[model samples]
Target chain A: MSTTDNTESLVQLHNAGLREQGRWRVRGISLRVRAGEIVTLIGPNGSGKSTTAKLALGLLTPSEGRAERRPGLRVGYVPQALAIDAAMPMSVDRFMRLSNRLDENTLVEALESTGVANLRHEPVTALSGGQYQRVLIARAIAREPDLLVLDEPVQGVDLPGEAALYQLIADIRRERGCGVLMISHDLHVVMAATDQVVCLNGHVCCHGAPRAVAEDPAYQALYGKLSPALAVYTHHHDHEHLPDGSVRQIDNNASPGCGHDHG
Target chain B: MDDFFVRALLAAGGIALVAAPLGCFIVWRRMAYFGDTLAHSSLLGVALSLAADVPLIPAVFTVSLAVALTLVVLQRREWVSTDALLGLLSHASLAIGLVVFALLERPSAYLAEMLLGDILTVSQRDIVLIFSVALAVAVVLLLAWRPLIAMTVNHDLAEAEGQNPVLAHVLLVVMMAAVIAVAIQIVGVLLITAMLIIPAVTARRFAARPETMVLFAVGFAVLATQVGLWGSLQWDTPSGPSIVVASLAVFLVSLAVSRGRHA
Candidate 1:
C-alpha cells in the first residue's frame, strides 16, 4: 500500500472468491499491488494463500467476486511446489528459454543475479532442492516482468539460505522497482522486509503493516506463539541476524529468536 | 512397397509428425488417463454415427470433444477424483457404445477390426482426414508451444506471466480429443494412450530439453511404426497392437538403461 507512487496497480483482487468442495477456498479478498513494494500473504495450511495467488494470476476464475490485472501486466512467478516433472531432464538454461525466448545474455544475467549462473548447464531435475529453487527463481527473474509473484519461494532451501533469498527478493525489488506479491509462512522474513502483510484463514483475517498484523489477535490465534519472536526481533537492535535468523539482544542479553517461527 | 504399405506408411508418418510433440505434453501433464478417456469415448461417437446414420469421423470427433468438455467441468467441481472420473467416463462411454452396437444388426465380422484397427485398409478419405487433423493440431501446437511449456512448469506462474494458462489448458484438451479421434483408427482406443505416452516416456531418457525430447519422441514413433510394420508383415499379426508393443518395448528398454546407470 505504501508504494512509491499513485501509479495504477499491477494486479488487483477485488473481493475475489473461489468456491469448490462445498466451501469457499478463498473469499471476499480484496488487494492491490503496486510497483516498488512487497506484499506478502501468510496463513496456516489451506487458509487459501495459494488459491488467492492463483486467482490473482488468473489461473482460476473467481466464483463470486472479481479479480483483475492491469492490461498487459508482465508478471514473473516463482511457485512453492517444484511443479516441473521430475522425470523430465532439463537444464537451467533450457528452463529459462522455455519460460521466455530470452537471448543467451539475458539468461546468463538472470542466473548471475540469482547466484546460480554457474549451474546454467546443470540438469534442473538433478540439482539439489536448494539449487533447483534458485534455478526457478532465476527463471522467473529472466523475464524482466513488471510484477513478481512468489509462492513459498524458500521451499527446498536451507534456513540460512531462506533469509538470503528474501534479501535477494528485496534486492530485486530495489533494482527493478517491480511490484512483488509473495506467500510465506515464515513470520521473520515477512516481518523484516515486507511493506504490508495479509493474514488469511479462508478469508482476510487481518491485513496492514507487518507490525500491526503481527500484533493482531487473529494472527496470534492462527499462529500461536508468533508475537514473541516478532518482539524478539524488534527488541534486538545491535545483533546481526544469524544464518538461522535468530538474533541476540545486547541490553537484554537473551537470544531473541528461538527459531520456532523460522520456516 | 505395395499400395497398402504406402498408405499405411503415410498414415503412420502423419500421426508421428503431429502426435510426438503433443504426446510430450500428455506425458508432462500426466494426462494419460484423460487422453484415454477421450479416446475410449470415440466409440460412443462411432455408436452415435451408426445409430443416426452419420459419418464416423465427425461423430467421433464431436463425442470425444464432448467427453473432454465434460471432464473439464467435472474437474472444476471435484465431485470425484481425477482418475476415478476418467475411469468412470472411459468405461461408461465404451459400455454405452458397445450396447448401442449390440442393438444394431450389422458388423458380425468387422467388429474385431473396429475394436483393434484396420490401418492397412484405410482409404484415401481416411488418410485425408488424418492428415488434416494432424495439420490443425500441429499449427495449434506451434502457436502455443511457449505458453504450453510455461503452463506445464507452473500454471499460476504462466497465468501471472500473461500467458493465459486456462486458454492453454482448454486448447490442450481440444487438441487431445482430436488426436484421440484420429489415432483411434491407427491404434485402437485401448492402445491410443500407449501411442501418446510411450514415445515421450522413452525420449525423456535421452534428451535434456523439452523440444529435443519431442524430436526424440518423433524418432521413436517412426521407429516403432517401421519395426511394427515389418514385424506384422513378416508374422501376419495385427498392425495396431504390433506398433503399441514395439513402442512399449522401447520404453521398457530405456527405463532399464536409465535405472541401471542411476542405480
Candidate 2:
C-alpha cells in the first residue's frame, strides 16, 4: 500500500480479514485515512465495503488481521441501514447533543452548515428523507470527528436532496479538514465528491486517482455494465458542488457543465 | 387511603417509575419480547427459591441476570433468531420452574403468589429492594444517557463515534432484567411485560423527543398506576391486570390526542 502524505493519518486498517456467515470472507484489505482527505470506496453490493467500514470502526473484529485506531482519534460514521426507530421521537438538537462534549454554537453551526438549522426544534421523525440524512450529517459533524465515514449517504434520497447533501459534505470537509471515507455505489456522486477512489470486489481491486481508477480495465470489468446511467458517470470529473452552488474542477477529464444531462 | 390501598399504590408506583424508561428502550430496540422472556424466567427463580428455601428477590434477580446474559450471548452469536430464542427461553424456563414447583417434596401455596401477584402481601423489604433497583437503574441510565441514545438510535454509527455498542446493548438488557425481577413479585410475569411496554408505546405518540418521550412514558405509567390501583380498590379486581388495562386506556387516549393535534 502507498503511504499517505499526511502524517496525521488517524486510522489504519492492516491486512484486515472480515468474516461473514462464520467464514473468513474478505481478506488482505488495508486502508490508510489521512487527517484531511476525502477517500471514497466504490464497490458492488456484497463486495464487503460495509464490512470494511465496520472493521475500521472496531464494530467488527477481523478474523485474521488487525484494525489500529489512533488513541483519542474521534470518528463519525453514517451507516447504510440507519437502525433508528422513526416512531420514537427525537429532535435535531437532541440528536446533535448525543455527541461527546459539543458546544451549542458548534451544534448550531453544524446544523447551519448542513442547511438544516430550521430543523433544530422539529422532531427528527418529521423530517423528509433528505432532511433526515442532512440532520444525521449535521449531528456527525457536531462531534468534530477527526475522521468521518459515510456509507451510501445519498441512498433513498431524491436527486435534489442528494446534491444538497453533497454540497454540505464538501463545505464541512473544506472547513474542518476532517478525513472522509465514504462508501458509495453511486459512481456519479462518488466521482464528483471524492479525491481518492478505492475499488473493491471482495478485495482491493484498485485505489488511486478517481479518473485513473474509473478507467482501469479491472474497475470497468467489475462495475462496468452494472448500470448504463452509472457508466456515463465513470468518465466524469470530481469536485461535487460547493454550498454557494458553485462546482470546482478536480481534474481536466470532464468539462464544467458536463453534468447538465443529470439536470 | 387504607393501608392495603397504600401498599398497592406504592407497588404500582415502583413498577411505573422503573418500567417506563426500561419499556421505552425495549420498544425502541425491538427487544419487547426479550423483556417478557426475562420476566418469564423469574419463575425459575421462584422454583429455585422454594427448592433451596431462599428469599425471592435475590433469587429472582440472580436468575434474571443469568438469563439476560444468556440472551445477550445467544443474540450476539446469532445462535437463533431473536424472537425464536426469546420464545424458547421463555417457555423453557417457565416450564422448568412449574415442573420443579410441582415436584417439590414440601410444596407451598406460594406458586399462586408468584404467578399472579398479591400486592397486599408485599413486605417493606420488597418495597426497599424495588426502590433500590429502580434508583440504581435510573442513575446508571442517566450517567450513560448520551451514549445510550446514540447506541439505540444507530448502533453502527454510535460504535464509530467511540460509543461501545456491545457494552451499551448489554447494559440495557441487564437493566431490563433488573426491572423485570424487581417488578415480578408485584405485577407477575404475564403483566410485567405490559408495565415495560405500554407507557413507552403510548408516549411515542404524545412526544417528539427522547427526553419528552421518557417524560411522557413515566407520566403515563404513573397515571396508569394510580388509576389502576383506584379501580382495583373500587371494583375488587386484580391489580396487575387492572394496571395493564389502565395503561391500554392511556395509550389509546394518547393516540387520539396526537391524531387530533395532527388533524
Candidate 3:
C-alpha cells in the first residue's frame, strides 16, 4: 500500500483462480506486486497459499480469471522445499547454477550473501534443513531477478534462524529493490516486513496493509490468538539482527511505527 | 577384435554414452516407470516398422515420442493414478505390438532377436545410425542440461526463474525417446530400462555433484557394456540380458558399499 504509484508492477493477478478435478482450488484472488514492495500471502494448510504463488508466477494458469506479468520479467523463487532425489547427487554449487548461467563473482556473492558460501561444495542432500533453505535462497538471488517469489522460505529453521533468514530477505529487498511476493503460514514473522498481507482460505479472506489485515476480524477469526503476537512483534522490532550478529537499525521514521494505540 | 565385435562395441557404447546422462534425469524425476513405459512402447514401434516396411529407428523414435506425449496429455487429464496409467500403457502397447508381430507372420527367430537384442550382429550401418542419434541427443542434453536439472530439482522454481519447465520436460521426453530407439538394439525392449537406470543408481554412491554423477554413470555404463560383451563372448550368453546383469551387479555392489560406509 505504501508503494508509489509510479513504481512498475512486476506481476498482477486479476480475479485469478484455478480449478482442479471439478473443484476450485483458489478463486477470486487479485493482487499486485510493484517494484521494491513486499506482498505476503498467509493461510492455513491446503488454503492455496502455494497455489496463489504459482498463479502469480505464471507457473499455473488461472482457470477463470487472469494472471499477467511484465514482458521478460526475471523471477527468483525459493520453494517450500526441493524434494531432490536421493539417487541424484547435487552439490550446492551445482544447484546454484541450475536455472541460469551465473558468472563466478555473481555465484560466490549470492552464496556469501546467504551465508552459505562454505556449503558451495557440500552435497545438497547432506545439508541440514536450514542450510538447504538458505542455499535455495542463494540460488534464487544469484539470477538478480526483477521479482522474488518465496513460498514458505522459513519452513524448517529454528526461531532464531528464522528471524535471521527474514532479516536476510529484508536486506536482499533493500539492496536489490526487487518486488517480493511471499507465502507464509507464520503470520507473526512475516507481518513485520510485509507491506500487504493477503489472508487466504480458498479465496482472499481479508487483505490490506499488514497491520490492518492482522487486526481485521476475519483474519483474527481464521488465526485465533496469533493476531496479538503479530501486532506486538511489528510494534517492537524497529531494528533487525543480521546473521553475522550485527544489529541494523531500520528507518522507522520513514514508515509508521506503532504511532496508533493497539489497545 | 572381429569386425562384428567392433561394430557391436561402437553401437552399444554410443547408446550407453547418451543413455547414462538421460538416465540420471529419469532417476532423479522418479520416472523409471515412465522410461519402462517408453521402452515397452518401442515394441509397438518395431511392430509398426515391420508391418509398414519403414526404417526401424525412426519408427521406434516416433512411436516412443507419441507415447510420451500421450502420457503427458493423459496425466493432465487426471483420469487415473500415474503408476496405474503407466502400467496400463506399458502392457497394452507390448500386447498390441505382439499381436501386430503375429499378424505380420514374422518368424519367431526374428521376433526373438527384437525382444532380446542380437548385439553381436550389429552392422556398420547400425553403428553409424547409433552414433548419429547419440551425438545429436548428447548435444541437446548438454545445451538443455541446466534447465532440465532445474525442472528436476523443483518444477515451480524452474518455471518461476524463466527456465520454461514445460519446454525442458518436452526436451527430456524427446531425448528419452531418441535414446530408447537406439538403446533397443543393444539392450532390447525387455531390458532397456535396466540400461537407463542401473548405472545411474550405481553412480549415486560416489558422486557429490550432478555432473559427477553423470560422469560416473557413463563410466559404469561403458564398463557394464564391455564386461557384458566379454562375458557373452566367453559363455555364449545373450548380450542384452548380459549387459543388464552386469549393470545390476554394479548397482548391488554400490548399494553394499554405500551401506557399509554408513554402517
Report DockQ per prediction, comma-separated: 0.62, 0.66, 0.76
Alpha-carbon interface RMSD of model 3?
1.0
Model 1 Cα lDDT, one tens digit per residue, A1-263: 23534555788898999988778899999887877778899887888999988888887889988987888888888877765687566777878877568988888888887778999888887788888888888878888888888988878789788888888888888888898999997555656677767788899887765655665667777676545665465334212332223221111111121111211
Instruction: Residues B1-263, candidate 3: write the lDDT tens digits.
Output: 78887788778888899999988988989998999999999999999999999989999999999999999889887879999999999999999999999999988987887877877668788888888988899889888888888888888878887788888999999999988998787688888888988898889878888888999999999989988877777788888898989898888887898899999
Question: What TM-score does chain B alone reach in each candidate, compared with the true chain B?
Answer: 0.93, 0.94, 0.95
Instruction: Give candidate 3 regions above 4 Å deviation.
Output: A225-263, B249-263
Off by over 4 Å in 1: A1-7, A14-28, A44-46, A60-66, A201-206, A212-263, B249-263
Fnat per model, in the order shown: 0.83, 0.91, 0.96
lDDT minimum window of 10 residues, candidate 2 chain A = A254-263
User: Model 3 — TM-score against the truth?
Assistant: 0.89
lDDT of 2 by residue, A1-263 (tens): 11245357777788899777877667888877776667788888888898888888788899877898889888887777774577668777778877577787999988887788988999777788777887788777888888888888877678887888877776677777888888987555756567667788788877665565665777777766676555655544322322222332343222221121110
- What would the TM-score be for candidate 1 when compared with the true structure? 0.86
DockQ of 2: 0.66
Q: Which ten residues in a row have the lowest lDDT in candidate 3 chain B?
A: B114-123
- Tell me the docking grade of candidate 3: medium
Q: Which stretches of candidate 2 lie over 4 Å from their true place?
A: A1-6, A22-24, A157-164, A186-188, A225-233, A236-263, B1-4, B105-109, B252-263
Is 1 or 3 the stronger prediction by DockQ?
3
Q: Write the per-residue lDDT of candidate 2 for residues B109-164, one digit (tens) a residue.
A: 57766776666777777777888988999898898887888888887777778887
Please give, for residues B1-263, the per-residue lDDT of candidate 1 as tens digits: 77887787788778877788888988888888888788789988887898999988788889999989988889977777989999999999999988988898767555565667666776788799889999998899889988988788777667666777778999998888877777766677677778878898899878888889999999988888777776776787777788888898878877898899999
